[model samples]
Target: MYTLLSGLWKYMFQKDEYCVLILGLDNAGKTTFLEQTKTKFSRNYKGMNLSKITTTVGLNIGTIDVGSARLMFWDLGGQEELQSLWDKYYAESHGVIYVIDSTDEERLSESKIAFEKMITSEVLEGVPLLVLANKQDIETCLSVGDIKTAFSDCAPKIGKRDCLVQPCSALTGNGFRLSTEWLEWLLTVLGSNGISCVM
Candidate 1:
């Protein structure tokens, strides 16, 4: 009976929860990425068709349980009009996943500006960041290093935040495993910092 009681206690009281925000410019595949994540982690999750995905006008939310932690992702719209509302979620987010379209070289400068602005926000100071240079399957796509260099201006502004830039093809599920890698790192960071994961 002691083992049963201990299991019950852990199930009831030892859940770790975290909030994550997904942001990027319009048509950068934010919604598709969210759907892919849900499908990847959820056993019975029946989300929208990947090929039919479209621009997210407002927000898309998803939750997944890995180990003892429950991660809640708030995928905010990336349109120019919706970008201003991103700060509303920053204060609550434990980390951020900023997506970039590596295949769209013409918009690299624009994305860089947006990234710099987000990282510089006071509310998001010290928040860990995962920058996904998506669309790696495209032959003409920019490399992960190039994407990182483009956002190099935001380095100083990152300050205490942990940051990583990884290449991914959300459409083809390439490099998706990196998501789990980052989540593990995030847990370690929270533990070392004594940060509460309840939110």
Candidate 2:
């Protein structure tokens, strides 16, 4: 039984990664959100993606551990056309994150579209969703109520969707800790019940 014991030890030492998909309209600060997350728990993770423009064609993958589980954050393309291809990844996603460019009043409609597509997609149902209404530092951001109303208008909450709208400013690192804190809490709850999350 040496082989069996060795295999069990290997599995026990291995860390499981939960896939968290982050999506938003172009310039919604998704890449920045990830960079900040890395910087938070890690000793010194410099978030340079903040200054660069991102056009995510495939996917931007980032990993951070909550307790024992490594979270894989997927920073999806915010470009209008690329977003059309996002449905394929939903099947592989463990959770959904809708990042909003709160400064872009005109693009709020697009966020509605993305959130709608995710809620309606057959593979994404029942997954917990967190909507980061980002760019709160900007003067032109829509209020949290407005963003929530937008989602409520789409008719998902009434149907049993786990969602939260948090006003965040990734540029200044304003509300990131709150969001990640919730993430840790959620993972803890799920893990306690044996959700296969690696600690």
Candidate 3:
């Protein structure tokens, strides 16, 4: 009877947890986006100073609870050497958020290359993907359509998984609502499909 009551209590109160990865090139604002997301979603979280945030050399982690779902974000370093480590976490992640520095036109191709490699990995197959075209607060950043066009060739590699390229400014918190909503929606879909995201 005690075991049954404990199980019932946990079932009623435990939140379903999911892991999401934030990947991008160096200086693409992956850490900034993670900070903003935590600040916006976690009521008591007062995130760090965005400007003072440095390039992540290893990994930065943050957690936020939305409704009954808890999302654990892994913000990995984007340096070439660090990218090799990304796949080590791919098998465990439920989704991926790839941030692109829209204002850095010179690195667009490079970013696309990394993105293509990430999506093609067999371990990440069927994982939901969110491509954030960040730095939209800059007057000259590329638009969502522009980024999409640049990555159009990779669509076949993306397959039928849930994917979205959203315009956002990590510094200004633009597009966070849509991003989080999509994650919440993923929880619903995964639940219906009997997929377990708990780790």
Candidate 4:
């Protein structure tokens, strides 16, 4: 089940809606980002506390405001048990954010496989993909070029289907705005083209 951390969710939504799915390997900080978003919603995030927050079960839904659009964000757990549920939201996501722990070199091969399988699926074949090369503040993370090489085949071919390989740090808020803005622009463009998607 999903929970809302803010009371302003409903009143804030506009007709131009978009859903962004955040997927990555286990311990990729997907859940932490959502919790930080909750703290941002509460407007009291000075140094932010993460003690009571729990790892996402299978999926969690959160909301964010980007430009004039209300973005519905789904944070998906990347565990073996949840692999089957990936496609369930594939068709729903207009944009995707794939996170990776920058220092985890051992999992690079595994990440490439997960990305390939997800992109090759009939449902996620054409949506815009954002590679959040997360945890960049630390050393030993793969370069953005490295990830692009990993998923070269999955890059978008046209208007709303293109993929952007953006490196970001979920812990320090770096590149977060870019992630939101990219999604906002892509959503606006897609909506104008009559692509009706659900999140």
TM-score of decoy 4: 0.74
Ranking by TM-score: 3, 1, 2, 4
Stretches of model 3 off by over 4 angstroms after superposition:
175-193
TM-scores of all predicted structures: 0.89, 0.85, 0.93, 0.74
Whole-model Cα lDDT per candidate?
A: 0.83, 0.74, 0.87, 0.69
Q: Please give, for residues 83-111, the per-residue lDDT of candidate 2 as tens digits.
A: 88888788777777788887787877877
| Superposed model 1: Cα runs more than 4 Å off | 1-14, 176-179, 197-199
Candidate 3 lDDT over residue span 69-185, tens digit each: 888999999998999999999988888899999999999999999999999999998888888889988999888899999999999999978777778888887664645665666
Between candidates 2 and 3, the TM-score winner: 3
User: Which candidate's TM-score is highest?
Assistant: 3
* True-structure lDDT of candidate 2: 0.74
Query: What's the lDDT of the predicted structure labeled candidate 4?
Result: 0.69
The alpha-carbon lDDT assigned to residue 72 of candidate 2 equals 82
